[model samples]
Target: MNIALSNTSDKPIYQQLFERISAQILKGELENGYCLPPIRQAAQELSISVITVKKAWEELERCGLIHTITGKGCFVAELSSDRKLQIRDEMISKQMLLDTSYYKSFGLTLDDVIAMLKKVY
Candidate 1:
């Protein structure tokens, strides 16, 4: 697994870990049945707390992006292409809801947001 952690970001370390790994798994960059490193190893490599990596792994399992086997570590879940798209859309939609709320609070319209996104994206 590849990860880059930002201590300065507003998001917690565990959340960043979860989002990046999940995106990788959904994008097929991390193939189905790929075994993730154990939590302690991941934490040590990432220079973060073991508890944080464990939390992120748990969230991945909770979202059905990965599954754990006793003594075997966690592996990426096997998912159909359609299911991957579905999960990706669901995750994006949830983030969009939060982003839209933030934009609205700033009095930005959909067009304004789209325009800004176009420039950044």
Candidate 2:
């Protein structure tokens, strides 16, 4: 597994770790049963505090993307294709709502948002 952490990021180190790792897992870059590095190891590798790694790992577990085994380490959870799609959609939809709300707050109309999205796509 690989990750890049930005020191000047607005997001916390743990959240940045969590989002990137989770996105990688969802993209099948991290296979089922693949064990993530230990908290201390990951922290050392990333040059961040171990507590940050621990917090991110706990969040991945909370999202059901991984599971921790006693005396071992966390492994990516096996998910069915349908389940993967469901989880992916749920995650994407949540982000979309947040993004849309931001646009709405800026007084952007549906047509305005669609046009902007079209330009990007």
Candidate 3:
């Protein structure tokens, strides 16, 4: 697993971690049953607090994105394609709504948003 923390961003480190891992799972970058490093090990590797990593892992579990086994560590959950797509759309749509609200506050039109999205997408 790979994650980059942004200390300057409004998002917490754990939230960033959760989003990255969630994206990987939904995109099939992380396959079902793929085991993740232990929280302590992942924290050491990322130079983040163990608590932060633990919270992220917990959030992944809360979202049904990962499953934990006693003593075995966390693994990506097995999911049907339809279920994966459902979660993916739900997460993406929620974030998109938050972003669109910001843009709307700035009086940006849908065309303006499309133009901006086009630049990166």
Candidate 4:
């Protein structure tokens, strides 16, 4: 697993970690049953606190992306293709809901937003 942490980012370290890992899992970059490193080891390697990594791992578990097994480590959950697509859409729609609210605040219509998105995208 690969992760890049940004201290300068507005998001907290744990949140960043959670997002990166979840993205990888959803995209099938981290296949089902792939074992994640222990929290302490990950913390040492990433030079972050154990609590941060733990929090991120907890979030991953909460989201059903990873499962922890006693004596073994955390492993990516087996997800169907349809489930992956459902999760991808859910995540994107959530972000879009927030973005849509922001756009509405600026008095931008859907067409205007789509146009801007097209340009940037």
Arranged by lDDT, best first: 1, 3, 4, 2
Provide backbone clash counts, one per model: 0, 0, 0, 0
Clash-forming residue pairs, model 1: none
For residues 1-121, write the lDDT of model 2, one tens digit per residue: 8898898998899999998998899999999999999999999989999999999999999889999998999999998868778878988898899999999999999999999999999
* lDDT (Cα, tens digit) per residue for candidate 1, span 1-121: 6788899999999999999999999999999999999999998889999999999999999999999999999999999999999999999999999989999999998999999999999
Residues 43-118 of candidate 4: C-alpha lDDT, one tens digit per residue: 9999999999999999999888899999999999999989888988888898799889999999999999989999
Which stretches of model 3 miss by more than 4 angstroms?
none
> What's the distance in Å from true for residue 9, model 4?
1.7
lDDT of 4 at 23: 94
Stretches off by above 4 angstroms in model 4 are none
| lDDT tens readout by residue for model 3, 2-115 | 777899999999999999999999999999999999999999999999999999999999989999999898999999989999999999999999999999999999999999
Clashing pairs in 3: none
The TM-score measured for candidate 2 stands at 0.91
lDDT of 1 at 81: 95
- Per-residue error (Å), model 4, residue 16: 1.0
Please state every model's RMSD to the true fold in angstroms: 1.2, 1.3, 1.3, 1.2
Q: Return the lDDT, model 4, position 59.
A: 94
Instruction: Report the CA-based lDDT of candidate 4 relative to the real structure.
Output: 0.94
